[model samples]
Target chain A: MTAAQPATGHDHVVVAADVNGVSVTEPVPTRWTLAQFLRDRLGLTGTKVSCELQVCGACSVLVDGAPVSACTYLAADIDGRRVQTVEGLAARDQLHPLQRSFVEHFALQCGFCTPGFLMMAKALLDRNPDPTEDEVKEYLDGNICRCTGYEPIVAAVLDAAKRMRGQA
Target chain B: MVLPPFALHRPTTTAQALSLLAEDSVPYSGGTELLLAMRMGLIRPTALVDLKRIPEMQEIRTDRSRLLIGAGVSHDRLATDPLVEQHARLLAAAEREVGNARVRAQGSIGGNICFGEPRSDVATVLIALEAELGLANSAGERSVPAEEFFLGPYWTARDATELLTAISIPLPCAEGVYLKFQTVERPTVAVAAVRRPGGDYRVVVGAVGEVPVWADYPGVGEVDPVDLVGRTSPVSDLTGSERYKRHVTEVYIRRAAELLAESER
Candidate 1:
C-alpha cells in the first residue's frame, strides 16, 4: 500500500486495468470515455461508438462480464477492472463462435452494428449460456440493427449458444 | 461529445465523503445520469466525488422494522438481492425493468433518486412503498420520504453538500404491481398500486407528469382512477398528448388496482 496522495485538479490520471486479457496502464484524461480509450488509445477499434447516449447499444462493451455503454463510461473508472471488447472475442486465426454464427446466419448486413451486437450478445451468453428467443430479444432490445431485420441476429445468438454448449 | 474536464475524488468513508462535498464538487455514482448531463452541458461540476468505493454505501441489510439498501447498490443487484425481493417485491419488479441491462448494471439506486428524474420507475415504486432516503453532510444526517424527496424534474430535496447514503423501507413493505405504458426508453405513464400492511391501499402515478401523484384508499373498491387522474399534471411531449397521457393514466391506475386485487387471491 502506498501513502495517500494529495487530491489535485489534474486532468489526467493513471489507469491500470486488464483489457482483453492484456494488462494496460496509462495516464488517461479524466473526461476520456472508455470508447475513446479503447479505440484511440489502445487501438481496439472493434468497439463502435454511435448514439453516445446510452439508448443505442452501439458502444456496448463488457466491464467485468456485464454489459456497459463504453461511450458514457469514464476510462478512469476502469482502473483495476476487466474489459472485454469485440476484438477480444477471437483467438487468432479462428473466428469466435458468435462471429462465426453471425456470418453463417447472415446476422449482419452493413456490419456497422455487428460488433456492438456481437459484444452485447456475448455478454448475455456469458451470463446465460442457453437463452430462449424471447430472453435473447429482451436482452438485446437495447441494441439496434438497421440490417437483416434482427431475426437472424436472434437466430445467430441461439446458434452460438448451442455451439458454446457443445450441442451444435 | 466528451465530458467537460473535472477533478475526481474517491472517498471510502461517509465522513470523508461529506468533508469533500461542496457546491461545485458533486457526488458521482453510476454516471448514468450525471455524465450524460455533463455531455449535454446541462450540468457542469468542477469536481466529482466518486462514491462507488465506499463500503457502507454498498450494503443491503435489515435494521429492526426497516430494510436498508445502500445508496450505491446497482439496479441489477436490487432486482436480484434476496432481502429486497423478500421484503420489497414491488421494488424488485420495478428494478428489473429500469433502463436496460447495461443501465441496470451501472446505474445506482442513490443516483437514480438524487437525479430526481420524473420518469424514474424506482422513484414511483419507492414512493408507493413509503421508502425513506438517508442523506448525510458534514453537519449531520437526515431522512426524507420518497414522496417528498422529489420536488420536480431534475430537482430534489437534497442540498448540494449532502449525499444520499441509503434507502430505508419499512419492513413488511407494501406489496403490489407496477405497470407502465412505455413505448420509448422512459415510461409514458407508470402506476404502482399496492396494499400496505395496515389494510390501506396506495396508487402512485408517475412519468406522465412533472412528479409522481399518489392517493390512499381504505379499500380496493375505494380506489378511484378518475380522482387519481385529476391529480396528475401530464404535459404534452413526444410520448403522448396530455389528454392521451391522462387517458392512459386512468387506464393504468385501474389496471394496477385490478392486478393488485387479483394478486391477493
Candidate 2:
C-alpha cells in the first residue's frame, strides 16, 4: 500500500521511504508536505495538520527516529528515510503502552491532539526510555493540547514510561 | 500553504551547487526557515539547490587552533557532538534549546546564521565566541567574521550567488554563558557573555534588536550593561516595547556576566 505508479513530470519527485514498516515509493509534488502525502496520497489520516507552521506539533512524525513537523517538512525530504506515524504504533488489535496510558489517564477530551501527543511521546520515549517529568515536559513543549490541560497527558507519559521500562 | 512550484536540484559537490546558485536559485539545507519563508510568500525562488548531498558541508573537524564546523550539520548533532561539546560548549548549550527537539533535529547552524533572523540564538552565541563564517561561490571562498556577516533582520552579507560552507571558531575559544528571556516561541532577549583565553570579556545582546550588539571589556569589572544597552535599538513588537526590551537586555547581560564570573571562579 506504500508504493505507487511512478509519476513522470516537472514539479514532482519520486520519494521512496519506509512508512510504519511498509515501504512506499511514490511520485509526490515537490511542494507537497509530508502531512499531505500521508493523509491525502497514502490515506493515513492519523497524522493531523494544524497551524501549518512548525509552531504547533499537530503533525509531528518521526523521520529516522527524530520528530519533525510534517506540515513544514517536504514530502520529498522523506525519501530514503524511515517515517513513523501514530498509525504505526499498534500491533494487530493491541494498543501501544503509551496509547493505553493515554486512555486510562483521561489524557484526551477533544481527541484532536491525541495522535500528535502519542507520536511526540513515542519519540521522546524511544530516545529516553525513562524520562523525568521535567524532561518529558521539555521534550513535549512544542506540542499544544487545548482540552486536557496537559497535566493528565504528562502523567500518562510518565506512567507509560514506567510501563515500558517494566516498572509498572 | 503550498510552496510555489520550483525545480529542486540535489548537488553532490560544492562546485555543482555553486554553478546552480543565482538570483532565482537558492541554497537550501534543512528547509526549516527557507520553506517557511517560501510558503509565507516572502520568497519564491525558482529553484532550490539542495546542499545536504554535498559531503564537504557535513563535516565537523578541527584545523590547527580553529574548529571547523560544516554548514550542513544539524543543531541536534552540534548539541551532542563531542567536538562541539569539548570546543564550543556555549554554542552546544544554546543549540540544545533552540526552538525545540524538532528544530534541533532539522535546523542547521549555517542555515540559522544565513537566515539572519534577529532572534537567532545561534547568531548571538557565535558572535560572542567570535566565530568566522565561510562562504563559497563559483569564483572562490572567503571567510567573514560572524559579527559582520549579519547585516539586518533576515539580511546577511552572503551574496545571491554565494553559499555558506562552514563556520570556523578560533580555538582556545571564549568560554562563557548564554542567557535568554523568552515569553514566546523565540527569545525576547539573548545575551552571551564570555571571557576569552586572553582574559578579555565580550557581551553580545541579540533578539531585541535588528542586529546583535556587542561590547568588549578588558576585564569583567569594566563591562558596562548600560553602555551595551545603548548600542541596540530594539524593535517594539508582540515580544515587548522598545523600552521593555532595553531593560531586559541590560538585565540579561548583567545576569550572563554574573553567571560567567561565578562559573570561572
Give a tens-digit lDDT track for model 1, residues B1-265: 7789899888878888899889999999889999999999999999999898789999999999999999999999999999999999999999989999989989999999999999999999999999999998888899999989999999999999999999999988998899999988889999999999998999999998989999999998889999999999998998889999899899999999998888888
Lowest lDDT sum, 10 consecutive residues, model 2 chain B, at B1-10
Clashing pairs in 1: none
TM-score of each: 0.97, 0.97
Q: What is the lDDT of candidate 2?
A: 0.90
Candidate 1 residue lDDT tens string, A1-168: 122333445677888889999988788889999999999999998888889888889899999888999998999888878999998899997999999999999898888888888988998898899999999999998888876459999999999999999953
Q: Which CAPRI quality tier does the interface of model 2 achieve?
A: medium
Off by over 4 Å in 1: A1-9
Tens-place lDDT per residue, model 2, B175-222, is 999999997779999999999988899999989999998999998878
Backbone clashes in model 2, listed as residue pairs = none
Worst 10 residues of 1 chain B by lDDT: B8-17
Which regions of candidate 2 deviate over 4 angstroms?
A1-10
TM-score of chain B of 2: 0.98
- For the second chain, the TM-scores of the candidates in order are 0.99, 0.98
Q: Score the docking of each candidate (DockQ).
A: 0.70, 0.52
